[model samples]
Structure formats: structure tokens, C-alpha cells
Target: MSGTGDDFKWFGEGFDGFPKRLPEDVVEYIIFIINSKLSAIQTRERLQGFQRALATLEKKFLKEYIWQRESIRMDLVCDNRRWFLRGTTNYGDSVADEWLIVYFLRELSQEFPDAWIRIYDTDGEFLLIEAANAIPSWLTPEVAENRVWINNHHLCVIPVSDHDNPKSLAIEEALSIINDVPTKLQHLPKIEQEAFYRLKSFPSAISENQHHATLPIPRKLAYILRSNPSYIAPAVEAFYLRDPISLRLLQPEKSRTQLNFPPESFVSVSVRFTKVLYAQLLGQQWVPPGPYGEALAKLISKESGVPSVSREKAEIGIKVTAGFEMLAQHKLYADKKATREIQLLLEDIEAGDEALPSDDEIARWPKREDNEGWLDIDFVEFEKELAGKGAGSTTRGFGDKNAQDNLRKMVERFNKFIEDEDAGLDGAKGLGLDPMDIDNDSEAPPVGWEDPEDSDDSDDNEDDDEQADKEFEEYERTFEKFLTLSSAEKSALLDDARELAQVEEAEKEEDEEIKKLSEMMEAELFSHGALNLGAKKNSGVKPVMGDGEGRGKAKLEEFLEEVDDNDVEYLDEDYNLAENMLQAFKGQAGMAGPAGNLMSMMGICFPPDADTDEEFKNKNKDPVNNK
Candidate 1:
């Protein structure tokens, strides 16, 4: 491992071996030079003389320089049916080239379908960190350490008991695990798979020689990426995925409900490729290179009528695209939340709550003998029970309607209710109306004049009247006590009463509205029947002609028959007179004499006079008159 090019045996072909003998700081400095300076072909060419001198001094520098141009740094080996594609980081830094290797392995799996392609990085497990939660339970860190690989486009956790053993044992272990649980850990997670599919077309070559056109990204991000182009690949993939958390990183919260923030304010201030802004760029037919980003850029430019693309326009498009992505992510989160809530609800139902009535209890309830009766449902009691159970629970229950011949019984009850007016009288004091004023206005009897009972049997009737009078006196006393309260106390009590009344009034109004809504809904449900075919038995409009033409002819004939004969004769005479007058008027129009013209001017028709016609012709024949 001498400094001379020919003697540097440790620097193998394809830069497989590293400069292990070199000091750590020197190796790090060489890595930095390779990543920063040798990334582009032009830079490499310009530094060729310096690299040659450095290579002659320390040959490991040349190996690092050559490694920069290659896209994927990997070694391939095969044992029986298992194909091992081993990858390692270029220039001792795995972070710089891990994604490129992962993407290349995916492309390789698609290319070699039948082969058991087991791909892994020597430095770290592939995709295991990203999909740790999604992977199977058995894929523990210990089991997966140095054993995890992507097989057949799926994450396969193959445990190896000893690293010293051949690679075939690891393949056998994978096969055994697959046999036990075929679907476990051997499939890429849905979200991760989608991400790979979207980012599959990223430029595979890791070099600054190939210029990558700017993506529709934020200006700040663009600026950041200009310095660190290595971040571009991951950034593009993240943009495609449009995860809400990622999208919202630099976006400001929108004040959508603000009065001053009009809807038109959201209109792009510059040319943005908004028409093609979709979740996953679904509408674009554009591809990359020569016109690298030309198709999308041109389409967006044409849509906005702005001929050129600028960083501001690109930033706008990126912002809107992030909005679309955010909307999708929100919907996904909502759907997941709804699914979880429904699952919990189902579990609660299965667990069963004691407050709910059982099926047997509902079945044992009595049936109604007749319909059209008020259901025996104590809603107040039901509400109390529901409140006791808490808002988080609900249940099904039953009702009984056992009133027989309800309509007739309801009429009788109404009559009895109206006859017993004592209930109305009891509320008179509360209504600020004196009950005694409504009962009677006659003067009281003299103190010594007592009416003698007609018989002993009448004493009970008197006693009952006395009891009624005593009750009325007690009610009057209560009313007087209420009036004796101070004005302030009375006002306070009145206000309290008014509030209660207002509450009751509001409740009544609400109940009425609900009842009216229910009735309208019921009407709407039945209204559709009117629109059904043949629902209307007869159309009111009479037929113009057909078998139904004579349907109303009888009424016309009867009306004609009811007319007098004299009236018909008079109608005929009037018609003849009118015909004669019309003929005279027409004849007058045909007359050609002066008398006829005079009659026509007067609107009176006359027979042409022979003398007048000769007189007119003679007068017109004179030369002076003709001129």
C-alpha cells in the first residue's frame, strides 16, 4: 500500500477498498474534497493536475475521485438461487449515497423478477428505520441488524446467527420465516411503496455534471438547495409525497374567516403553473430532460399567459401544490379518525352496557288494541335515565300504546275536561285576575237571616258547598299575602316568574317548529305519490277530439234547449239585417260617381245617381278642368 500508483494495491478496481491506513482527519479531508470539488466533471478536469500530484503522494485520493462519478457503489454476488446485491457508502459517507442505492435496488428488482434479489447496505438497514412501526413484530433490532434486505421489492428481515457463515444461510433463514408467515414483513408498506413509485424517476446519476433544472419549490428552499445539491433528490421525493407535516413546514396559516381577506386575495400574484398543480402531478403528460422541465413550465406559462418562469412564480406553484397535498392529507387523517371512532363504537356495543334494555324486555311489552292513540312514552323520565348514563352512550328502547277505541275516548275526555273549569279558575290569581269577581257580584245575605234546610238529607250538600267556600277563602288569602309583599320584593318575584314564562314560551316555540318540520317532511314523503304514473285518475282539461269529445256535449245541448223560440227568431232577424247593411256598404265602395264618393266619405252607402255621373264626366272633359 505505497503512495506510488502501481504499488497502491489496497485501492482496488471500482474503489472497493478504502484508505484504512490513513489518519482519520486526512481521510475526512479527502472525503470533503471528493464530495465538494470532484462532484462535477468540469471541476474534476480542472483539478486533474492537483489530483495526480495528490494521488502520487497518497493514492487513496484517486480512488475517492473516481467513486464520485458512479451512481451506485455496490458489489453483486450469487450463490445458488439467491442473488446478493451489497452496497456501501461512497467516500466513507453512507448518508450521501443511501437513497440512490435504495432506488437502484428497486429498479434492479423490477428488472430481475424471478431472482431472489437480497439487497442491503453494509452501513445500515434499508428502509427499516422509516418503516419500523409498519414492519412485523418479529423484526426486532437484534434480529434485523446486518440481516435486513429488500427482497423481491419487499422488506425481508433475514436473521443470521453468525456473520462468519456463508450468505446462503441467511437466504435459507428468510425462506423459513416466509414459510411460517408468508405475508409478514415481506411486503413494502403502502405509504412507503407509494413514495418509491413517485420518486422512481429521479436522476440516478449522482454528479454535478448533469444539470438538474429547478423544481417548483419555495425560493428559500431553492436557495438552500443551491448550496447543498445532495438534498435535492430527497426534497423532490418529499414534495411528491406531500405529507401534511412536510408541506406545512414553511407555510403560513390562512385567515380564511377574516372579513378583510377576500377570496380573490388567494389569486396568484405571479405566473404559477396552477393548472397542472395536482396531488401527485396527476394531469401532466410532461417528461424530463432536453426540455428538462420544459413541458410543465411551458404548460403553466401558457395557462397564465406569462412567457417566462421566475423563482417567485415557481414558489407560488409550489405553495398551491402544497395546498392540494395538505387537503389530501387532511382527508386521509379524517377518514382514519372516523374509522377509529367507529371501531371504538362497535367495541362498546359488543361489550354491552347495563343501562340499555335487553331484547327480551322489549319483546315482553304489551301491544296496542287500536291505533291512533298517544304512545305511553314518558319522555321526561327517559331523558333523566339518559342523563344518568352520560352523553357518551346511547341505546334502543320500546313504547306501548294500549288505549282502545282512542278517538271516541279522546272526544269524551275533551268534553269532561271542558266541563270541569276548576283547573282554569285556580290559575286566575297567577294571571292577575280575581276569581271572586268572575264568580259573583250579588250583595251578601243579612247576618241574622239563615235559610232553613228543606230536609236532613240536604245537610251533606250544604257541607260540601261550605268546604268549597273554605278552599276559595284559603286561595284568596294566599293571593292577598302575595300582594302585601314590598314593591321591590314583588318586582323581583315578577321578574323571576317572567323568566320562567319566557323559558316555557321558548320551549313551546321550539316544540312547534320541530313539529311543523316533521309534518312538512311527512308531506314531502307523500307528495311524490302525486307525480307517479296514473296517480291522477282524470285530467280536468276536456279532450279536443276523440271518444271523450262528447263527454261535455250534453251540457252544451241542454243549455241550447233551454233558450226561448222567440229569442232564436229575433237573433235570426238581426243577423239578416246586419248582412243587408254589410252588402250595401260593399256596393257603395264599387260606385264611381261624385254622389257615390260623397256617400262613401260620409260612411253611408247609396245607389249611384245617373245625372251625377254624366255631370261629373262633362265637367272633367273640359281642357282647363283636365289640366
Candidate 2:
């Protein structure tokens, strides 16, 4: 490992000796990984297949392979308004490879501001997860399946639920729907915009290409730490694991790399450090080293507003503390279960509940004995007021007697309406004849109508129509029971019956609609099959001589009719023969396979004798064969 030239020192002088070329297997693996990420950014075509491909790669390779290489390449192509990424790695290579990919993609985003580019690996979507809490309320996993996209390096959600359609079609339709609507970063929720900007600032080291670290470290790492200084914490943490002999790589004797930092400042710096640590743990190609530990000690002193410690003993402790805190933060975000638990805790806290309730606590919550007082209080004041209102309840005793008489008259009037419902008379209007008007008794049945013994025709009618008599008697008994209920109870029962009838009618209509749709689809399928069958059958039939174009039309109609009559039954027999014959005599048309062969074998197949045949032969002559 020799020092790289100044022009090639992307990772700075400290990383010059670091390996540039990875092992062949590792190179191949990283290339595949890079290509997979690029493929997702390129196009939405076969997106479901793309997801499956990524899953297969992760299952088969990711766990086994180590990303030791510090270089990567991309093969990109552009179609009309879209970029396509090929699964090859020939488009030159760059150092700080992973960041370089992000840099290049950001540049592409700037170039094609309208075009959406999605970049994701097995880790999940890069931009969406950062602003997960701020996504739209309607964005469920199913709705957001293929709608997550990036336009101009800003996260934009296409709010449509079209998971049933192909990914390509869904994307196209979604974009078209919102084509005229401008989506700006400022339009996003405050928290979401903040997240986007934070992520945007993380890649500034690569984008700006400037070094900011005060120590004599690699230029590449200097730029990265300059953009997000907390990244140095993870590097310092990794440096601690090295053996004493490996410390020689730091070149401590070099005057240019020397730095002094204090131990007490580590506390404040650790408190201010990023908890997510995405840049250090997931962004960078590798955990940087060399002078980063000492550099981080200096960072701690500066960030905490404490003066640097000159004592070597205090500086060592400060560096160690810095590394340990960085490692802790990195591990915290990396834990799978911690994120979910933290989210639940945050939700609880937001809802004014500091802790998640246990199952037993939840069960006991509603068992408070104080709630029993609610049952002791009377809430029937409205019902009492209602009973006092109207003409039936002016005074207690007199009103009660009038109510009983009115009820008897109302039942009689309702029964008469039911009998006249078969005629042009309206049941509702007939029942509205005012039961309180005692003088309007003309509509009521004659005296002794209720007594079977008083009617001479009752016995004769019962014997003549036994079943009708039983049904009428049953109806009368049910009506009597219905009349016994109070006004409120009767009203409630009628309302429930009306609602139930409405629900049943709606369900019946829906079922009928579904049945009709199914039948229509089946008919369409059958019709399409019939048309295809007619075409195939027509293809096998030769035109009759001298019948001209009109004859061909008649023959096609006849064949279509035949297909319609036979329907699916034709699939069993004529379909096979038609398919085979068409295939056997394809292109030749006039040459009827076995018949032509038999005629040729018998020596009866004459050469072209007619003028039309010779003219056809001359027109169809092969220039290559001159025949």
C-alpha cells in the first residue's frame, strides 16, 4: 500500500495506505448490490420483480459477503424522460463509493427535476424512513407499496392506492394525476421538512468536496466529519478495539497530527451528539480511523465550550469517552426492537399517558365503584314531560281515561285501513282520520262485527276457507298484542322494522349487481373466445374459386354463426384441427400439406399452366434463388 497522488487522495493522506481494490468475490458482490440500488432508481418497469430480485440477493449473498472495498461504479442509460440502470459496473469507479452513489444520484435529481428516482436496498427506502412519522395519514403499507418516490432529491409521496395495477402503470397514472400540481419542500409538514433538510446536509461533504477537520487526517474523512462531526465518534469507537501494535498506524510521532483535548468536555458533547447516527453507521463506506480518536477529543472540547486539556492523561480519557458514547448511540439505533418500543413510548407520552398500560390495569380501569351513582340518578324527565304534553294528558285521571278510549278507537281504525289497503285507499292516510273525534265513527265496522256468534256467514266462510280464516285469526291476535304496547315502544318497534327492511333491500340489490357483473364478464369472455375460434376456423378455410370478396364475407359470417352455436363445445374438436392445419400450412396458404404431397407424389400436380398462376409466380419470385 503506497501513498496515492494528491489528485487521487479522495480519502486524504491517512487513507492512502488503505486497500483500494477489494477481493474479486467482494467486488462482484458490491457491484451486484450497487446495481440493485441503481435498478430501483432507474425505472418502475417490473418493480415487483425488482423487489423479489433484491430479496433473493439479500437472502443469498448479503450475510455472507463483507463490503471491504472502498470503490464503486454504476452503468446508467437514459431513455425519453427516464433513466435506466444496467446490471453492469463499467461506468468508471469512485472512492468513498457509497457516498459517491448518493452524490451522483443527487446530481441526476438536479438534472431531471421532474423525473422521480427511487433508491432503496434491503435496508429499506433511504428518504421515506427518515420522515416516516410525517407521511400522509392515508399512506398505509398497501397504498404506499409502489407510490414512494423522489423528485429533485426531495421526498414526494404520490397519494394513490393502486396496488392492484402493475407498478409501471400505477406510477404513470399517479404522476399524470398530479402532473400539474407543484410539490415543494416547504409544503411538507414542519417536522418532515426539517428531516429532509437534515438528510440533505449530511451528504454535503461529498457534494461540496471540502475538508473541515482540524487534524491531519484523510481529506475524505475530513470532509465527512466537517459536514457531520458526530460521525467521527463511531470511527473513534472502532479505533479502541485495535491492538497496541496497530496504534502505530496513527503515526503518533508526526508533528502535523498532534492534538490536545480535555476529558470533562466529553459529557456535553455526548449529550448533543445525534442519536440516529445514520451517517456514521450506514452512510460511510467504512468506519474511518487513524487520527479520528484524537480529533474527536478535540471536537468534544470545542463543542462543549471547554478549553482543551494539555495533559496527556486527561486527553486519553476524553478520546476514550468520545468513542464509547458514539458507539452507544450507533448501537441504540441499530437495535430492531428498540425503535418499535421507543415509538410506542413516544405515542404514550404524547397521549398524556407516561407509560403503556398493562392488560390487567386496562381491565381494572372501568371497575371503579364510584360509577354506580350514575345508575341511581333518574334520566326520564324528557319522557315525563312528553307524557304531560298534547291533548291526552292535560290532567292525570281524566287524561288516562281518554287515552284508553282513544287507543281502542285507533286500533279499530288501523284494522279497517289494513282491510282497505287492497283498494285505492292509502293505508297511512286512512290511519290519520283523528281517533279523538268520537263523532267520526262511520268508518268503523258495524256492531257485532267482532262477535263470530252474531254473524250467520262466519261459520259458512270458515268452512269454505279454513286456511284464510286461520291466517285472519292469527293476524288479529298479533295486532292485539301490538296494540298493548305503549306509544314509545310501538314507535321504536316500527322504526326498527323499517330499518331492517331497508337493510335487507340494500343487500338484495348489491347481491343482484354482483351477479349481473359476473354474468356480463362471463358473456364477454365467451364472446371473445367465439370470435377467436371463428378467426382460427376461417384461417383454415380456403376461398372458393370465382366467389370473389363478397363470397369471403358470407363464408366468414357462416363460420362465426357456427362458432356462436357450438360455443365452448367447439374447443374439444374443431379447435385442435384448425390450430394444427393453420400451423402446418402457415405462409404457403395454397399448399394444403398432405393433399399437396399426395398430388405431388402421384405426379399429377402439374406445373403452372394458367396465366394467373404464372403471374403470381413471377410476382412472388425470390431474388436470391431467381425462381
Candidate 3:
């Protein structure tokens, strides 16, 4: 009887006057019965009544009913064409709910083909029979873990702890359930299956009569719909189709921990300014050249103002264009001046002079001339004489024809004298005088004269020679007196005369050798194909003459003058001893020591050591231990 009453209430009066509008009270009471009942027929009949009421209100609230009507129309289109629903109960036969599900599926499939849907029975088991043609049980398990429904199809069931309210299952949540299914089932009619599952699983109609009894929309989804009202539920469902969990998780968190510190705008400004300054400096726009360049140029100009193009540009134009070059030149000049002053100061200190310029003062002073005026008058006169003569005449010319004639005569005379000496030596040899014996003679031979007719002049020359013979005899007697003495005495007398002769001969020979060598070297050096080895005239220094036997004596005299008193005394003592020994050799015949020995002792006494000390200290002290 209870079963009959339940069936009668479900099939007989539930969907009575189905296509027409139900009374508001009847619709509300029907929604209440649908919510309380577990039977599919009762739920279906109540949903049919809600649909009729929605249609009746459609014309009156056309704009509001457009989305609802369109949803119903899409569901009907899908359900009516199915074979299983050909002759079902009136609400079961209605295809509006199915068509609405198909519409949502089409929208979800466009965005994400991998999306799917699931349906659950009132007991939360796979509702295979109820959704047999629309969605299979196999698609439901894919999202069984993150499902919207739990133990039962009742609206009281919720999957996640946080989403316990059935009101949370809004259009977005329904779309999410479809998207969360396995990717393999996404190509199925996901949106249609999702809508079908939502109706079968929840089994409640959304109508004005049951408006108060309907589950509340999820706060997140409701906010989204309110914010983006232009987008319909199917459009929002499309977003979830691609990524269900992530899209749902995008809901704003209530307890967000965002940072609140103000951004530092000055950092970028400071960096930009620093970069600009660095670029300017690197580009050489800001930094100028130092003072050394100009200082050096000024010094050069002051010291030697030879007007030159480069110098003018360095001094004037360079200052205008690249001024630092001039500054660098100035610094260089200052450094040079400072260096020279330091050297001069050292020299002064060595000389015991107290007054000397400081380095700073020297650096500040103007450039001075390096060369001192030391003119060679003879050279100047010679140059003047050369200038006076015409270029051609100055060359090695036959000086005034008469002078050439006189030179030729002089050459002939010199040649005749040489010939006469040869003849005299041959005659002496023929007269039994040994040629070697001639070299033994203390005096050199007198100059011989040439006569054209020696036979005719012999008698006249004999008469003149007779008087000369008497004077010569007397001179021979005097000379023979010194020769008769012991060899020691004779050598002593000869040495006195030789010393006097040597002095005069040395002076003459030194002068002649210097002049000859200078002329020879000058000619060789200046000649083509030879090295131009000559002192630079600009240096204003004379060329040093080569040391010769007699020429070296002057250098010795200078050295002797420069020697300290102690060295002079030592030399004088040794030389006096040598003189005494020489005198003793004269007194005692053939008793002289080696002359070389005396010379060696003199050399030791007159050592080349120069006394550097202010006092006449022992300059010749042994280096190992100077006592």
C-alpha cells in the first residue's frame, strides 16, 4: 500500500498539466517533495512541473528567462533524439534538459577536448541506469577522488571538507567536475554529460518556486559571475575545461600575505646618472690633459725660440685644441729643470759651496742656455779667410804660378841632399870604415852640399877648407878631451847635453806630430767611403789629441801639479836618490846600476794615483788595508 501511494504521488499527480504553469504553492510543494524523496520518478515529475512554471514565467520575464529557456532547449534537443527516451514518461521524454547539457558540452569541448563529466546515484554509487545513454559509469571514476558528490546523490553530500555545502556546486563547479575527469574521456560530450550528471546526481529542478530551497552558489564562482556578467556559465565552463584544478584554485585567498614596502624609484635614477657620467668620462669629454705638455713646450720655446711649424702648433694651436698636451710639456720641462738643479746641488756640496738652488726654485726658473760661449779664434779666422777666397780658388789650386815654381826648386834641393848622404856613406865604407861603426857615432852627420864640377872647385875649396881645418882641429881637440875620460864620465857629460837637446826637440816634434795627425785624421774622416768620426761642432767641445811620446809630457806635468804634496815629496826623494846614483856611476868608472832599475823606482814613487781627499793623505796606500 505504501509503494502504491508513493507511485501514485510520483506518476499520477506529480507532472499533471505538465506543459501548463503550476500554481506557485503547488510548484513549491512539489519542489519540497522532490527534495525529500529518493525515488527517480518523483524527482523527474517535480522537475517537469518546475519546467512548466519556468515556461509560463518566460514571457513575463523574457530577458531573465532567456538563459534558463536556452539551457532547457539544449537539454531537450540531446534527450529527444536518444532511442531509450522514445516513449518514456512525459518529464523523461522532455529533451530540454538534455539539450541544455549538450550545449554546455559543446562549449567545454571547444576549449579542452580532454575534459569529461560524471554522475552519481542518490547513494553516491555509479548511477549507470539513470544516465545510461548520456554518460557511462566508466567516466565517473576518473574524478571520484575530487568529486562534487560523495556518499549519496542527496544535496547534503559534499566531496572536499571545505566545500561541504551543496550550495557550492554552482555552474563553475559543475564545469569543474567535467574538466577533472580522465583526459582519455575528455573527447566525449563532456558538458552535456556534466549537466546530465548534475541533474541526475542532485535530481532537483531550479525554478522560482524552489528558489529558496536551491543550493547557494559557491562564493568564488558567484563573485566571478558578478564581476564578469557578460560571460555565461558555458563560457566560464570553457576556462575550467583546459585546467580544472588550477582554474578553481585561482580564487583569491582571504588571508593573503603580500609585501607592502614602497618601491625605491631613486635607485634607477642614480644608476642612470652614474652611467651617463661614466660614459662622458670614458669618451674623454670631461677629463682634460694634464699640465706637463704645455710646460715642456714653453720651456723649449724659451730656451730655443727657433720658429718651426710644429713648435708653433704645439705652443699655440695645441693649447687651443688639445690644451692638456701643453700642460704635459710644462710638467716635462719642470722635471728636467729639477733634475739638473739636483745634480748641480750635489756638485756644489762636493765642492764645499753652501749656496745652492733648491729643487722647487729650480723647477720654477726659466729655461737657460746650455752652451757657454767659448769661441776658437783661429778656427774663426780660418773660416773667414776661406769665405774671402772665391770657391774655385779655395780648392787645391796651383797657388800663384811663381809659388809653385819655388816649391819645385825646394823639392829638388831636398832630393839632392838625400843622394849626397848616400854617396858619403858609400865612400866611408870604401875607406875601410865599417857601415855599422857609423851608427856608433854620438853626433849625426852634417848636411852635405851638391857641386856641379867637383874637380875644378877642389883647389879653391881646398884653400877655403885649409882655414876651416885649423878651426875644426881645435874643436876636435876639445871634443876628444871628453872622449878620453872613462865611459861613465863621458856618458854623464853626453846625458847633460842630450837632456837639453831632447827638451827642445820634444817640443818641436810634439807640435809637428799633432798637426800632421790632425790633418791626416780630418782628411780620412771627412773623405767619402770613410766614417765621419768628428766631434759635433754644436757640442762646443774640442777633439782630444792622441797621446805621443813627447806630447804625453804635458799631461804628466798637469798631473804632477794636481798631485798632493805628499806624493810630490815621495817622487822628489826617489828622483834625488836616482840622481845621486847616476853621479856615483860617473865618479866610479863602469860601476853604474841598471838605468832601468832607477826608472822602476821613480815609477813607483810617481804613481798615477790622484789624491781625492781634501787633506794630503796617503793616496797610494794599499787597497787591502790602508793604514
Ranked by lDDT, the better of candidates 2 and 3 is 2
Which lDDT value does model 3 have at 124?
Answer: 29
Candidate 1 residue spans exceeding 4 A from truth: 1-96, 145-147, 156-172, 175-185, 188-627
TM-score-wise, the better of 1 and 2 is: 2
Clashing pairs in 1: 289-292
- Model 2, position 394: C-alpha lDDT score: 42
- In order, the Cα lDDT scores of the candidates are 0.38, 0.40, 0.32
Per-model RMSD to reference: 40.2, 33.5, 60.7
lDDT of 2 by residue, 1-627 (tens): 112222343455455554243222221111111123345444444333333444443454233221222223334444455444433221111222333344444444544454455444332343444444445544433344335555565555565434543222233554454444534222355434633433343443332222111112222222233233434434443434444333333433632332222122232111112111212322222222444555555544564333443333234333443343333233433353333443444455458666433334433422111111211212132233334332344433322222233343344444554566443532243223334744665787677546756566787777779988888999988876886678679869988998999999999999999999767644544432421344443343432222233453466457657765547566434554433322333323464444234335655342322234345468668989987
Q: Look at candidate 1 and tell me the lDDT of residue 85.
A: 32
Cα shift from native, residue 284, model 1 (Å): 41
Error of 2 at 27 (Å): 18
Q: Best TM-score goes to which candidate?
A: 2
Candidate 3 regions exceeding 4 Å error are 1-41, 63-71, 74-146, 149-157, 160-627
